[model samples]
Target chain A: MAQLTYREAIARGIAQEMRRDESVVFLGEDIAAAGGVFKGTVGLLEEFGPVRVRDTPISEQAILGAAMGAAMTGLRPIAEIMFADFFAVCWDIVVNEIAKSRYMTNGQMTFPLVIRSGNGGGLRFGAQHSQSVENWAMMVPGLKVVVPSTPLDVIGLMAASIRDNDPVIFLEEKALYATKGEVPDGDVVDTLGSAKVLRQGSNATLIALGNMVPRAQLAAEELASAGIDCTVVDVRSLVPLDTQTILREVSATGRMFTVEENPRLCGWGGELASIVADEIFYDLDGPIVRITTPHIPLPAADALEDLAIPSVTRIVETVQKSMNS
Target chain B: MSLDVVAPLLLDDKLDLYRSQFALRQFEKRAYDLFLENYVKGTSHLSIGQEAIAAGVARAMRPDDWTFATYRGHAHTLARGVPMAPVFAELMGRANGLMAGKGGSMHLTSVEHGVMGSYAIIGAHLPIACGAAWSAQYRGTDQVAVCFFGDGSTNIGAFHEALNFAAIWKLPVIFFCENNLWMEYTRTTEVTAVANPAADRASAYGLESIIVDGNDADEVYAVTAACVARARAGEGPSMIEAKTYRHGGHSRADPGKYRPDEEVAEWLAKDPIPRYHQRLLAEGASEAQLVEIERAVNEAVDVATEEAKAGAVPGEDLLMKDVWANGGAEWRN
Candidate 1:
C-alpha cells in the first residue's frame, strides 16, 4: 500500500477512469492547465490534453450541461463544480435535468457522469462556499450521492461512480484534502453504498460521512479511552446507503450517534435516523443522537467556524455525555 | 432582412418541408382538441406557428446530428420524424408513449430519433447541446447539435454561458432561438433589452448575427443549413434567431387574452402553413401534389389521435423501474 493524500487520490481516481475509457472526460474551472483551484487535479491536463481535461469558463450550468449531454450521448464524463456550494446557480441542471434525464427518458438516455465538488467547512470560505449540501442531491430521487472521507475511497468510489449508469454526486470534503491514507497500488475499485467499519466496538455505533468520518474515528478513539468502545462507520454513499452495516452495527451496540458537518435540519442523518427508528426501533437502547452543526449559516471567523462545525472534541463530548446518560 | 443564402431547394424538398409543416399544424390542432376533451393531461405548450423553424432546422441537420428542444417542443420532436402516434400517446400519458409515460408532453424524448430531449426549463438545454457537440468534437465526428429555445430564454444565465462556451470551443452546435413575439403573457419585446434577443447578442460571443423569417421554412432551412455546414466543417458555433409567433397562448390553461385581436390576426395571416403552400405552388409544385400531402397528413393525424386515445395508462410496475441502471429505485438493498 502506498500513502496518498486525499488531493492526490482525486487525480489518481479520475486518471484511472480516463485511462480505462477514452470516453471518460473531465471538465471544470481551473481543473485543467492550472491544476484546479484546490490543486487536487494537478496533473490531469498534462496527461490527458485539453480535449479530455477541459477548463470551462466560470459557467456551472454550462459545465454540468455539457457533462450531462456528453454522458447521455455515450461519454462517461466527470465534472467539478469548483465548490459544492456553487450548485445553487445550477441546481436546475443538477436536480431537474441531469438527475431526471434517465428516468424521464425511460432508460433511453443514461447519464453515467460524476459531478465532483469540494464540500464542508475548514478554510473559512464563509457561508456561501462552506455549506455541506450533499443532502441537496440526496433529496432528489434520481441522483446517487457519494461522500468519500479518505484517499482510498476518493479513488475507488469515483471509479464506481463513473462506471455506474447514473448521475453520481461525489462531494470531496474540503477539510480532508491534506489528510493522508494508505491506498493499495494498482487499480483500487470499490462498491458504492458500502460502509467501511474502520473501527469496531460494542458500547455504541458512530456513523459519519465526508469531514465528519475522520472526526468520528478520533472521537471513537477518545471515548474508548473512557471505556465507551464505540464503532466508527464511514457511511460513504448516501443514496445507496449501507443500511445493513449501519443497522447491524447499531443493533449490536444498542446506541447510535450521527456525526455530520451539515446543519441539523433535514440532514442525511435525519433520514437515516428515521429509517433506524422504523426498522430497528426495538433494537435500540436509547434515543438516536445526531451530533450535527447548528441549523444556522456557517460562521466565517476561524474560532466561530471551528466551534460551529462538529469537531473531534464536540463528537467525543456528545457521544460520552449521551452514553453516560 | 434574413441571412438567407442562394441554395435553392428542389421541388421535392419543398413538398417534403410542406408535408412536415402540415403534419405539425395538424398535430398541434388535434392536440388542442384533445386538451379540450381532457385527454392531454396536466399542461402542454404547443408550437403551432413555430413549425417552419423546427421543420427547416431538422431538415438541414444530418440524421445522426443531435437535437435539444425546450418545453414548446411538440413541433421539434415531430420535425425529427418521430412517429406521431407515440408522441400523441405521450401527450395522453400512455405506457407505449415516447418515454413510456414518464416524460409528459413538455419533456418528449426519443434517443433513437436523434431527438435528444425536450427540456421543460427555459434555456437549460442550450448548454446540453454544447455538451453533445463537445462529445462529437472529442470523438472527431461530423455531427452538429441544434438546440431550440424561446426568446424569453435569452435573458437567462445558461443561454449566455452556453453561447460563450460554444463560441470559445468552436463546438459543432447551433443555438436556434424561436422569437415568437410573446414570453408567456408578456410581450417578449417589452421584457427583452434589445430589438433582437439572439441576433444582437450573437456579436457579443463573436458569432454572426443571423436571423430568418421563422414562418418561411425555405429561409429558415437555407440559413440553418449554412450554419450546420459551418459547424460540421469546424468553423465553430452559429446563432440563428428565427422570428416566429405562437398561434395559441403559452400553454393550454392560458386563453391568450393579453394580445389584441388585430395583432393575433396579423400573425395568423402570416401562418407558416398557408405561406409555405403558396411558396410551394409558386415554386412549380402542382396543386394535386400539395393536396395529396395534406390528405395523407390529416389521415395519419386522425389515426394517431385514435391510437393515442386508446392507449392504456402505464402499469404500476413501471414506477419501480428505470430510476437507476438496475431498473429499480432502491436507495438501499
Candidate 2:
C-alpha cells in the first residue's frame, strides 16, 4: 500500500483502465495539456497522446452526446463535465439520451461510459460552481451514482465505474481532492451499491455520503468523548444504495443520523430517513436526525457559506439532541 | 437544379434501387393500415415521400459503414437490409421485434447491419455520429459513419458542435440532411435564418457541402456516393442536403393542413417512385420486369405483416430486462 491523494488516485485509476483496455479514452475541457483544472487528469495526456486524451470545446451537450455515441460504438469513453452545476446546460442529453438509451434500445445497446464531475461546496466557489446534484442523478433509473470520500475509495470506485457496462455518474468532491490516504498498490475494485463502515460504534448510526463521511467521522469521535458511541457509514453508491448494510447498522444502534451537503428538502438524506422509517421504525429509540445544508443557494462569502452548509459541530449537536430525545 | 451530368446506372443497379424503394413504400403503407386497425399501437413519423433519400444513402454506404438516423427511420432501416419481419414485429410490439419488443418504430437498430440506432431526438445523434466516426479513425479503420437528420436539426447546438469536431479531427463522416421543409407543423423558413441550412453552414466548418433533389433516387445515390468516397479517401466530412417533402402529416394524426395546397401539389407532381419508373421506361427497361419487382415487394410486405401478427407479445419478465448488458446489480430481484 502507498499513500496517494484523492486527485492522484483518480488519475491512476483512469490510467490503469486505459492501459488495460485500448477502448478507454478521456474527453473533457482542458483535460489535455492543462491536465484538468483540478489536476485530475495529470500525466494522462503525455502517456495516452491526443487521440485517447482529448480536449473538447465548452459544449457539454456535444461532449456527453459524443461520449454516448462512442460508447455505443465499442469505445469506453470517460467524459468530464468540469463541475456538477454545468450539467444544467446539457441536462437533456443526460436525462433523455444517455439515461434512456439502454432501456429505449431494449438491450440492443450498451453505454460503457463514465461522467466525472466536481461536486459539493466548501471552497466558496459561489452558487454556480458549488452544488451537490447527486440526488438529481439518483432520480434517474438507468444511471449509477457514485461518490467516494477517501483516496482509496475513489480509486476502487473509479476503476469499477469504468468497467461498468452502464452509464455511471462519478461525482468527485472538489474539497477532497488534496486529502491524502493510503490506497492499495494493485488494482482495487469495489462493487457498486456497496456501503463501507468507516467507524464502529453501537450508540447511534451516522450515515454520510461523499465529503460528509469525514465530517461524520469527526462527529463520531466527538460523540465518543461525550460517552455516546456512534457508527459512521459511507453511502458510496447512492442509486444502488447499500440498504441492507444501513438497515443492519441502524437496527444495531437504534438511532440514525444522515448527512449530506445538498439542500435539506428532497435531498439524499430524505431518502435515507424515509427508508429507515419504513423498514426499521420500531427499532429506533429516538427520531431520525438529518444534518444537511439548508434550502438556500451557497454564497460566495466564507461566513455565509459556512453557515448554510452542515458542519461537524452541527452533526455533533444533532447527534446529542437525538440521544437526549 | 438537376445534375448537368447524369451518372450512368446499370440495369441491375436501377432495378435494385426500384425494388428497394417499392419494398419501403409497401412496408410503410401496410404500417399505416396496421396503425389504423389498432394492430400497431403508438404514432409513427412516416417517410413516404422521402424513400429516395434513405434508399440512395443506404445504397451508397458500405455494409461495414455505420448509420445513425432520426425518428422517421422505417425506410432507413429497411434500406440498410434489416428484415421486414422484425421491423413489422417491432411496430406491433411482439417478442420477435427488432429489439425484442423493446425499441419500437422510432428506436429500431441492427448492429449486424451497421444501423447503430434511430434517435428520437432531432439533433442528438449528430454528435454521436461524429464519435462513431472518430472511433473508426482512432481504431485505424477507413469505415465511415453516415448521419441522417431533418432540416430543423441544423438549428440545434449539437449540429454545429458535431460539424466543427468532425472538421477539426478530419473524421470520416457524412451529414445527410433530408430538408423536408417542415419541422412538424411549422415551415423551415419560420425558424431558420438561412435558405439552405447545410450549404450555408458548410463554409463556417471548413467542409464541403452539396445540395441534391431528394425525390430523385439516382441523384441522391450519386451525391451520397461521392461523399462516401471522399470520407473513405481521408478527405474529412461533407454535408449533403436532400431537398424533399413529406407527403403526409408529421405523425399519424396531423392532416398537415398547415402546408399550402399549391406547394404540396407542386411537390406531389415530383413523386419519386413514378418519376423513377418513367425514367426506367425511357431508358428501355421492359414494363414486365418492373411489374415482377412490384409483385415481389408486395408479397414480402404481406408475409412480414402476417408473421408479425402471429408473433407473441413480450411477457412481464421482459419489463426488467436489458436495463444493463451485465444485468443491473442494483435492480436484480
lDDT to native, each model: 0.91, 0.89
Off by over 4 Å in 1: B1-7
Can you list the residue pairs that collide in candidate 2? none
Least well predicted 10-residue stretch by lDDT in candidate 2 chain B: B324-333
TM-score of decoy 1 = 0.98
In lDDT terms, how accurate is model 1?
A: 0.91
lDDT, residue A245, model 2: 91
**Candidate 2, residues A227-266: lDDT per residue as tens digits?**
9999999999987788999999999999888998998888
B1-333, model 1: which lDDT tens digit per residue? Answer: 234533678989889999999999999999999988988899999988889998998889888999998988899999998999999999989987999899999899989889999999889999999999999998999999999999999999999999999999999999998998889888988978899999999999998898889999988898888888888989999998888889889999998999999999999999999998988888798899999999999999999888877888899988878898778889996
Writing each residue's lDDT as its tens digit, candidate 2 over B141-248 gives 899999999999999988998898888888899999999999998998788889998778888999766889999999898888888887888889999999999999
For each candidate, give its TM-score against the true structure: 0.98, 0.97
Over 4 Å off, model 2: B1-8
